[model samples]
Target: MFVDSRRREGAAAFRHIFHVQMDGATSDRESPLMKYNYVALILGVLLILLVVLGNILVCVSVLTERSLQTATNYFIISMSAADLLLALLVLPLFAYSEFLGGKWTLGMTLCDALMTMDVMLCTASIFNLCAISVDRCIAVLVPLKYNQNQFSSRQLGLIAATWVLSLGVASPVIFGMNQVADRDLSTCKLEDDRFVVYSSVCSFFVPCPIMLLLYFWMFWGLRRRRSRTPLKDPCHRRSFCSTLVLALCHAKSLTDSVSDGEARTQRREGQRNRPKTVMRSRKASRVSRRERKAMKVLPVVVGAFLACWTPFFVVHVTKVFCGWCTVSPTLISVVTWLGYVNSAVNPVIYTAFNTAFRNVFHKILSRWM
Candidate 1:
């Protein structure tokens, strides 16, 4: 009995010591892990803040400002809504995962919903841009028909279609397609490889080419039209000059008659100003030159979009199709967030390129100040 008691006491002390060492090790491990992810946590929070604030500015500017209430701005508003929804619904969860060092502690159902909203909203953003490109193309080519200032039924239909199509693309995940048997619930991503291909093709591959082609056609038509008619930004000023000349001509007939030399000089001056007269007449008929200015800014927007998202889709597809090729989770996370960075970028692009948006942003921001 005495020997047995001694043995039991020794074993209990050893077990206690072992557990204490383990506790110490775990604390040490957790501290470094926490420190390692602190950068991600800080950056993610800033990104979320930027996206939320910037997109909100866009929404408010378009909604409140009458000048911004054009058809193209309506498309911009729709796109802003998508980005805003993405920042609100999707960025937080994904960012929290990054804070946890990319561990998805949020279970399957929430994760699937995240995936759904993420895919749908991002796709909608791209589609709206595509719609913008198409609208601009039509406006440039067939300027008379496209009401640059008003949203027609066709414009509303196009915006609605983008959202609906995005929903269609993302609906599969919501329908339990992400709930595959024997899959790890801790990992939150699309389950089916085929679905990856489908989403990539629909979201990036399909729209990108179409958008590029439309952009080409738009610029082509614009260049040809510009070459033929030569629309100038100083057209309004030209119209005023033309009006001034007409007024002088009308007023001159009542004045004392000029010498033959002076008469010839006046005739030459009127001939030089004749083109200005034509410009004055065409003032009401010229294409919306604001659309041309918009086209100049669009290449920057499209280039940024492509730069951010191209790597993501390329890596996304390669990981699926080339199973032998190894991609790190870190690389995947980097590219994914890089794509999310686009939501924050667009408002900056608009503010930089557009005077109307810039003025409104300044006005709105001044009130807050």
Candidate 2:
């Protein structure tokens, strides 16, 4: 009986040691894991703040500046508004999901709602950019037809159509067409191939090609106009040539006689003093310095959008088509956040390229100072 009691006590001590060891191991595992979570949380917070603040500044700058109230800028304002909605409604939820290790705790209904808003806002932003390219093309190619009275209605119609089309693409999920099943509760994704194709075409494929084509057309038109117009500095060269020709005439007349020299000098002086009429081409005058800067800056905006969003869409479409293919969660998260970075970039592009926007932004900042 004594031996059995001793054995029981030894067993209790072993179990106690095992528990202590496990506790230490668990803590060792959690320390780095907790650090990672903290880092991710901080990054998410900063990203949200950046997107929200940048887009808000853009919207405010547009609203406060009367010079920026053109039809094209109205589309820009709409794009900023859409991005602002994305930052507010979609990004916070995404950040929370990231914090929770990709587990969406926001339930099924809110999940659907969030996903719908995500697709709608992103698609609308793309359409607005495409519209901006088209509007700029019109303004460059046909300034007379791009007057405010004519273009305002067209721009308004385009903006309305953009939102309507975005809604149409995103509404299928809301109506239970493409939904997350209970078994796949861990994932919040659009599993329907049809929905994926439709949304991809509407959001990326169609608009991207249109934007590219319009920009190419704009560049071509600008290039052609530039080539046709003579360089502006030719006036100086022409003046030098005229002076040389007059000197040659005076030298020739000097050899002839004093009478001939005096006559030629008088004629040349009269020709030089006569009013010089300079005629500038309509196309050269039409594209102002500001418009040229915009033309140069817009391609950078489109390129940035393509760079940030293309990987995400490519992987997304691949996942939709190839069910057997495995994409790491980390890759997905990185690509998605890259796409979100585009929202933060838009306002930076505007402020950098646009003088009026920069001035307004500076004024707005000065108020705080």
Task: Return the top candidate by TM-score.
Answer: 1
Candidate 1 residues 228-265, lDDT tens each? Answer: 76455444445665655665675456346776667666
Q: Which ten residues in a row have the lowest lDDT in candidate 1?
A: 279-288
Which residues of candidate 2, in runs, are more than 4 Å off?
1-36, 148-151, 180-182, 230-284, 287-290
Instruction: Report, for all candidates in order, the number of backbone clashes.
Output: 0, 0
The lDDT, on a scale of 0 to 1, for candidate 2 is 0.79
lDDT of each: 0.85, 0.79
Write the residue-wise lDDT of candidate 2 on 270-346 in tens digits: 45553132122232344434457678778888998999999989988887888899989889999998998898998
Please report the TM-score between candidate 2 and the true structure: 0.78
TM-score of each: 0.82, 0.78
Tell me each candidate's RMSD, in Å, in order: 6.1, 8.0
Candidate 1 local Cα displacement, residue 97, angstroms: 1.2
Please report the TM-score between candidate 1 and the true structure: 0.82
Evaluated at residue 156, the lDDT of candidate 1 is 95
